[model samples]
Target chain A: MSGISLSTTSYRNVSIVLFTLLVVTLVLAELHLGPLAWVAALVIACAKTVLVAVYFMHLRFATPLTRVFALAGVVWYVILLGLTLGDVLTRAH
Target chain B: MTHLAIAPQFDDAAQQHESAALGMWAFLATEVLFFGGLLTVYTVYRMAHPAAFAEASSHLYTWIGAVNTVVLLLSSWTMALAVHAGAHGERARIIRMLAATMALGLAFLLLKAVEYYLDFHDHLVPGRAFRPDWSTNAPAAQMFFILYFILTGMHAAHMLVGVLVVACFVAVIRTTPSPARHANALELVGLYWHFVDIVWIFLFPLLYLVA
Candidate 1:
């Protein structure tokens, strides 16, 4: 919970909370939400992704090289989205 | 014995752990790009045929997808625990958690198999000869199904790989002499497993959340 070095007890504790959130978010996103479902879904998904990265992937205590590589994918993905959406959204006949 | 003997380049336990973690991250980054290509196709098609995209997306089995998401989320938690056990040099705990994660992953695959069976039976599979009573826009709908199968199918393949990887980790735990040397294996496999879950995180919304 506190740092890069994760303990099994910590993992188990975090698992319970994260999983409960996963279920709750899925139910809420599926049932009541309509157009805004994706927003909720993305937020929950981001939370889960961060948890896995920081804990299981060891990115919390990873070296500078590792962090750079991890962030590179994210930065590149964002750039991909920006460029693609820019092309699609900004284009006109 | 060979695995227990020593890795050539790694000097100490910490170096081995760092290298393995970093190596797995690099592999996952490439995986991100691999999935990125398919996601690009999805974005383009969704843009081109918004109505049909919405229609096709509406036909997905939302409950099944949601359940599988929960399953994977739980499995990832187990995976994180397995890594924790490894870091603490608790070999038995590592084995137990790894096995649990692998079983959950297999359960996810079985559920996905059922979903595909329904797809085929429903004629939801994309093809020129396809027939569906749900919508007249069969072509676009078929394309969506195609993308769905390809994307999720590829993901399932990755899950299978994760399962095998976890199984291997279990075996290593049984046979490897220096458990300390191989603690990094747990972290490496955990990295891959988490990446698989993260992909599904995005997939759940893309496939099932359309209104």
Candidate 2:
């Protein structure tokens, strides 16, 4: 917790291992699963994305401002998806 | 404590690193907005015609999509290693990892080309050649293919730019000794690469799975 601590080993280890687990889960879901396949895939995809950001991109080690920048994108994702779909879905057309 | 060729405007190397990182993050945030617009259109259309979109999505090859996902993941890991190596001033390791990342990026592009060819040959390419199932609302399904080509095409273009940027970053490190202080720029580029990976991560599920 001093000058620019870089936990490369731990981060990289988790990333590679998670990559394997993610692929296995993906293939299995593709093989089975009914209407839930898409849901499973989306969840897995989000997990993979988080691992890349926190570990691979080293955002876990980044400063608070940097983390804020990253989270802002997600905020936009919510607003964009929520607003556009909310308006369209609620209206009776 | 090494002398860094920091820009005159920057007070010190650490300040420079922070500024660069923040600037890159700001740019990435804008990219989210850029891509978000397309996603909104995509969602609206899909919401309006769920079954047709699902039908169009089924035509995609999930196995190939999985292959590309793994390829990009490996590239991202290598890119991460390159950033780590850069931090320690391990020049050779940096080169090796960056080269490996570049190689994987090229592999992803090649596989994508093959997939596109298959799409075209299967009559799945949007425009005139698009041959949707006759039973489905062919026009609405065509909309899916239209969005597919646009989304994936833009993503591929970003990957191409990333590959070039990594190549140049490698060349820069090779030419410059003690790239010690500039480690953050490499990390910033790594962030860009990972962001691209995230885009494809979401795209894979949205485009490849239908149920």
Candidate 3:
């Protein structure tokens, strides 16, 4: 999985690996891991999103402009989280 | 005949494919913001009443949410393969994969229906008739359920659209049957399918696991 594997994965293998990862994380995320459960779940979700974006969406072979457009979602999302959450988290009750 | 597949508006196949992909990403960008707004709301409300949000979240059926997550991710995988086949012009492969993706989407929706039914029975749905074991925090809990239903309902609506889109993609492939020339179609559908999956990727933990 260098630079998204260059479309190297077959569908069956890709599905199986991804499904297994999801199941394992789901089962694990259910336990009482304190705040860690939340953290772990978020991390797993990010990883899963990356897997789908890079592999399933074929961003590996995408042009730089296209990749920029694709990444714009993630980048802009962080901005959304940053600005709004910063305001919310910091404001007085 | 094969050359006519390249629309008159496009000079060549590759450029057409690139343009199509770029357009899809641009669309997905807006979709991200659309869902992002809801999620931002989620964050704000949760921060305001973390305990009540957590309580309401716990009332959610973890099993149902977990299973749905699996279903959607698997569907994305299937769509990936279908797109792979489409890129190479494998008609049978494209049909099979697309069918699998659509069926998985349907299965996800079916499970969602079951969850909604059970939540309603449990009085987890917010309305005048709302009731929950955590009645003391009922107001904040009700707020949680409101966002819950709205977000997941919106998500389910998107999934329904995904199913129909896959169905249409199947029809397109059947008519064109030229893998190399029609590669853009496959790629575009795969992108949309995965975008839906990505949305769930964020929603699952926020709604289900964080509690």
Candidate 4:
């Protein structure tokens, strides 16, 4: 039961590392990647999001039901994109 | 453990956790639809005027957008830290993180304001008064800029509300005796924060990178 607890130091450390990585990625993206730099930008973003959800949000120790709720949000987003785009693409120009 | 062991226990912590998770998930589903409508509109315009869209986008302050993205990302990081503090029963730490998140959120809104000001000065804003220096497809480009302002402006409004909410939460943490019930509240805010960040992630690529 106690295994779920995260220390403040660890949290700070993680935040530092994530922020540093984000800054570095932004610099690199600006310097060399051009418009396509969004790929690197997004990868860093996904990593940061995961870290927040897992460690900060306590999703790591959350019951399966909570995970289901978060996953449902993602799935719903996809369905929304799919259905809307379907109509958009199929409509006459 | 037998079914009876877990069944019929209104006080069962596990069952409560499950229900909470389910509730949060249901709300997030609605959020998906909310953002989906905007995405659809954005997509339609992009498809309608691909070249104009690209040209219009080039006028944007790319570095400002990049900085805003990082700022929001940092807010999310602090928010996550706040939630972690809540779970660990560290009220002080949670309050600190909440304050940090609010500050970063404010910073993002400030940067956005500056960007908007620049837009206005450059005549990049739409509504019958746009005057792009090097123009192509002025009408379509104007429409694109209009949509950009509305969408990002709405996002900024949300961020403003989010900052207020976080400030209120911090106050609660500081004043009231901490309650376990607030855990879910913290989590809900985290969900909202994450959703905002996700929207921007898509926006950055669509508006700035889709050349």
**Off by more than 4 A, model 3:** A1-10, B1-4, B177-180
Model 3 compared with the native: what TM-score? 0.91
In order of lDDT, best first, we have 3, 2, 1, 4
Candidate 1 lDDT, B1-211, residue by residue in tens: 1133347886765566566667777777789888987888887777777678778877788889988988998899888888777766677888899999999999999999999988788778877546767776777777788889999999999999999988988999878666655666667778888899989988987877765
The weakest ten consecutive residues by lDDT in model 2 chain B span: B127-136
Off by over 4 Å in 4: A1-3, A6-55, A87-93, B1-10, B179-181
Instruction: Name the lDDT of candidate 4.
Output: 0.73
Q: Model 1: runs farther than 4 Å from truth?
A: A1-4, A31-34, B1-8
The 10-residue segment of model 4 chain A with minimum total lDDT is A1-10
**lDDT of each residue in B160-187, candidate 4, tens digit only:** 8889988888888787564344665676
Could you list the CA RMSD of all candidates, in the order they appear? 3.1, 2.3, 2.9, 4.8
lDDT of 4 by residue, A37-91 (tens): 6467667666765776677556787777678777776777677778877888899
Q: List the per-model TM-score of the A chain.
A: 0.83, 0.76, 0.81, 0.75
Proportion of native contacts found in each model? Answer: 0.59, 0.62, 0.72, 0.38
Deviation of model 1 at A19, angstroms: 2.2
| Tens digits of per-residue lDDT for model 3, B71-115 | 887788788878767666688888899999999999999999999
Q: In terms of docking quality, how is candidate 4 classified?
A: acceptable
iRMSD for every model: 3.7, 2.7, 3.7, 4.7
Candidate 3's chain A scores what TM-score? 0.81
Q: What is the lDDT of residue A91 in candidate 1?
A: 73
